[model samples]
Target: MTGAAPRLRSPPRNGGVRHSPETARKKSPPPPPSSSAGGIWESAHFLKWTAADALRLPVRHPIPCVLAASLLFFMAVEYTLRMIPATSQPFDLGFAATAALHRGLAASPRLNTLLAGLNTVFVGMQTMYILWTWVIEGRPRSTIAALFMFTCRGILGYATQLPLPQGFLGSGADFPVGNVGFFLFFSGHVAASVIASQDMKRLQRCHLARLFDTLNALQILRLLTTRGHYTIDLAAGLAAGVLFDSIAGEYQISHKLNH
Candidate 1:
C-alpha cells in the first residue's frame, strides 16, 4: 500500500494568525460584562449585604442596640401625633418662632437667600449620605430600618397637611400653597439632616461629623425662616433623627459582632 499522503494544512489568510479550537479555548476570558448603568452600583458591592450577611453579622453591643430600638419606637409614636391634622387640641410653637425669625431676617434679603440656599444644599447632601451609609454598610436590615423610620416621618407630615408657616419665604402666602408643599407638620429636612449628622458622628467621628453637624444646625434654623417648619416640628424632627440613628447604629453593631 502506498504511504498515506501527507496532510497539508492551509496557511492563514493574508498571513494573519489563526487560532485553533484548543488555542481559542485557552484564550483569556472575555472581558467582564460591561456594567453600563450598573457601574456605580457595582462599585459599592462591598456595602451590599444580604439577609445571609445579616445572619452572619456579629453582635458588638446588644444593649445599645435594644436601647436604640426602644427610642425609635417612642419616636414613631410622636411622629404619629404630629401627623394628625391641625387639631384645636394640639399646640406648637411654630407661629411664634416662625414669625419672629421671619421678621428678624426680613432686613437682610441677601442673608435670608444665602441661608435658604444653604439649607437646600444641606438637605440634598443629607439624603445622599443617609443612603450612602446604609448601602456602604451592605446590610439589608439596616437599610430597611432606616427606610421604615423615614417612611413614618413622611406619613406624619403628609397626614397633618398643616399649612406652612406664615414666615416661611417671608410669608406663608409667598410660598406656593400646595398639597405636598404645605405638608409642614414635621420638618423632614431637619430630621433627615440630624439623622445623617449623628450617623456620621458615630461612624467617622471627625471632620465629616462636624460638617454634618453644622449643616444640621443651619438647616434647623433655616427651616423656620425658609422651609416653614414650626419650632416643635424642628424639635420633633431632631428627636426622630436621633432615635433613628441610634437604632441603626445598634443594628449595625449587632450585625457586625455576628460577622
Candidate 2:
C-alpha cells in the first residue's frame, strides 16, 4: 500500500468534453436502420395513393419525384394511343395490336395475361427512354418533367380520343373500370420502380419472388372481381411481369453499380 502511486485524474473544465462507458454504450443506434427511404420513393408512394384518391392522375410531378411519374404519364398516354384498335387517328399501336392478338388467346386467360405483361415491360422501358431523352433529359426537371410529359400525353390522348378509332380506346370497350384496374396495376409498377430504385437496393440480391408472388395474387384478386374481358388477363399478366422484372432489373443494376 505504501508503494502504490496516487491515481491521476484528468482535470475536467467548462470546455464540455466528457466521456463515459454508459455514453459509449448509448450509441445513436445507427439511425434506426432506415425503415424506409425518403425523397423520390416517399414521393412516389405518396403520389400513388394521392392519385388513387383523386381518381384522376393529372400528371403533376413535384420536383423531388420525376422518373416514375413521367413514366406513368408518358406510358399511359402513349400506350393508350399505341395499343387501342385504330381507324386513322392514333391510340397505342401496340395496345391495339396486342388487343387484336389477344382475342385469339381468350381461351387461355392466364397465357394471354402473361403476354400482355411482357409487352407492357417493353412499353415501360421505351417510355422511360423517351422521357430520359426528349422530355426530362439534359434538364433537371425530374418529376416535373414527368408531370409535363403526362400533360403532353393527356393532351395527345384527348386529341386522339376524338380523331382516333373509338374501338377500344374510345369505346365502352375501352372499359373504364378495366382501365382503372389496369391503372392500379401500373401504378404499383411505377411505385415499385421508384422504391426499388431507392430503398430496395439494400434488399436487392435478396430474391423477391415472394414479393412478386404477392403481386401475382393481388392481380388474380383484381381479375376475379372484374368483368371478363379478353385483355384483362393480358393486362394483369403485363403488370405482374413488369413488377417482377422491375425488381429483378433493379437488383441487377444495383449489383452492377455497387460492384
Candidate 3:
C-alpha cells in the first residue's frame, strides 16, 4: 500500500497567522486627526460652497430676518447717537491717566501714522478672512449677527460719550474724522479685532487667530495711548465681542435644531 500521505498540519487556530487581505482591510483604523494648516485649508467647507449655492438654500426660519431688522435698528440708533452733541458730564478718568504715561509717544505724529498704517493692513486681513470663512461657508447669518452686535456697541459707545471735563494733556491729535471725540466712549477698532480673531479661531486658522489676537491687544493699547477711546470704551468693546460670539453660537444651535 502506498505510504499514507503525510497529513498536512491543519492551520493552527491561533498561531499568529497572518490575516487575509479582506480582514486586514476591514480592520484598518480610521485616518488620524489632521494637525496641519494646509490640511485644514484643503478640507474647509468654505472652499466648496459657492455664493450661488448659498443663495439657493431656503431659509428654514425667520430668525435671520429678525436678526437683519435688529441690525438695521441698531445702526440707526448709532447714527442718531453720533448726531447728538457731547456733554460736560464727568465720567471716569482712568483712560486719560493711563494715556498720560505715553504722552510723548502719543503726540508723535510719525508714531501715530505708523500705527494707522498697521491698523489698515490688519483690517484688510480681517476682512479677507471674514469673506472667505463666513460668507463663503454659507454662514452669512452668523456674519450678520456679529455685525448687529457691532452696531449695538457703537450705539452704546456714542450714547456714553461725554466731553472730558478737562482734556487729557499730551493726548494724541484728534483723528481725521471731525467730531470723533463723541465716539470715544468705546473703541470700535479693538472690538472689531476681537470679533475677527474669534472668527479665525472658529475656522481653525490658528496662525491667523493668534496674529489677530496680538492685533487686538495692540489696538487696546492704541486706544488708550492715543486717547482714541476711554478705558470704558475698550472694556465695552471686549464685552461686545463676547456678546457677538454668543449670538453666533445661538444662531448655529437654533439652525441645527430647526433643520
Candidate 4:
C-alpha cells in the first residue's frame, strides 16, 4: 500500500491573523432567543433579581429601613383611624399656636385690621423686591421663580379647594383684590417672600434678606392668627418657593446653553 501524504494546514487569509482560544471565546455572543417562553423566563429572572437586590438594601442601609418602617406605621395608623365626618372639620395642631391670637382678633376688630394692613404691606414689599430684581438689578431669576410658583399654586389651589378655616377674620386691606374670592390651599404671600429673600441672599445682600425674612415671619404669624391660611398651606408654600427657584435656575441654564 502507498504511504498516506501528510496533511498540511492552510494559512489565514486576512493578514495571517489568528484568534487565540480565549479571544475567540470572548467575542460578542449571539442575541437571546425570541421565543415567547424564553422572553417570559428572562422577565421572571429579572424580577427575581430586582427583588433580591431591593431586599438587600435594608440590610445595607439601616436608615432606609427605619424610614420605610415609619412610613408603614403611619400608613397603617391612617388606614385604621376613623374617617372625618362629612360635616365636620379636620383638626390641625398648627391652629393651637394661633388660638389665643384668634381669640384676641375675634374680640378686637381694630387690632385685626392693623395686623391685616401690616401683612398687606409685607406683600407689597415682596412684590417690589421681585420686580426690582428684574428691572433694576437685571436679574430675572426671582421673577421667573415667582411666576412659576404662582402658576403652580393656582393650579393646585383650584384643583383641591380647602374650606376657609372657622373664625377666619377678613379685611378689605388684604392682598389680591381684598381676598373677595381666592384659593386657600397655599399662601402666595409666603411663597413670594421666600423667592425675594432667597434672591437677596444670592445677591449677597444679607441684610436685605434678613429683613425680608423677619417680615415674612411676621406675615406668617398674622396669616395663621387670622386663619387666612392653614399651617400646611404655609409649609407647602415655602417648599414651592424653593422648588420653583431651583427650577427657574435650571431653566436659565438650559436657555443659556441653547443660545
Task: By lDDT, rank the candidates, best first.
Answer: 4, 3, 1, 2
Query: Candidates' lDDT values, in order?
Result: 0.65, 0.42, 0.66, 0.87
Q: What is the lDDT of candidate 3?
A: 0.66
Q: Which candidate number would show the highest TM-score if scored against the true structure?
A: 4
- Candidate 4's displacement at residue 87, Å, is 0.7
Error of 2 at 76 (Å): 35
Candidate 4 local lDDT, 17-83, one digit each (tens): 9888888788869777677976778877566667778888888998979999999999999999898
Model 1: per-residue Cα lDDT at residue 48:
78
**Residue-level error in angstroms, candidate 4, position 80:** 4.0
Model 1, residue 242: C-alpha shift (Å): 1.9
Q: Give candidate 2 regions above 4 Å deviation.
A: 1-100, 116-139, 160-178, 181-259
What clash pairs does model 3 have?
186-233
lDDT agreement of model 1 with the native: 0.65
In candidate 1, what are the lDDT values of residues 1-259, reduced to their tens digit? 7998999987776378877889888885977866787876687876677887665544756676778889999999888874536544334455455566667787777776666565666766766776776677753433444565668877987776765444346432222222234456566676676666666565666788888777777666666556466677778877877777677767778988999
lDDT of 2 by residue, 1-259 (tens): 4787989987775476676868867864655434566654665755657546554433344442566678889988887764535445443333454454434455556664554465355336434643453344442222333343334434543553332123322112222313343322223333333322322233452444344445444433333323222233335334533454444445556777999
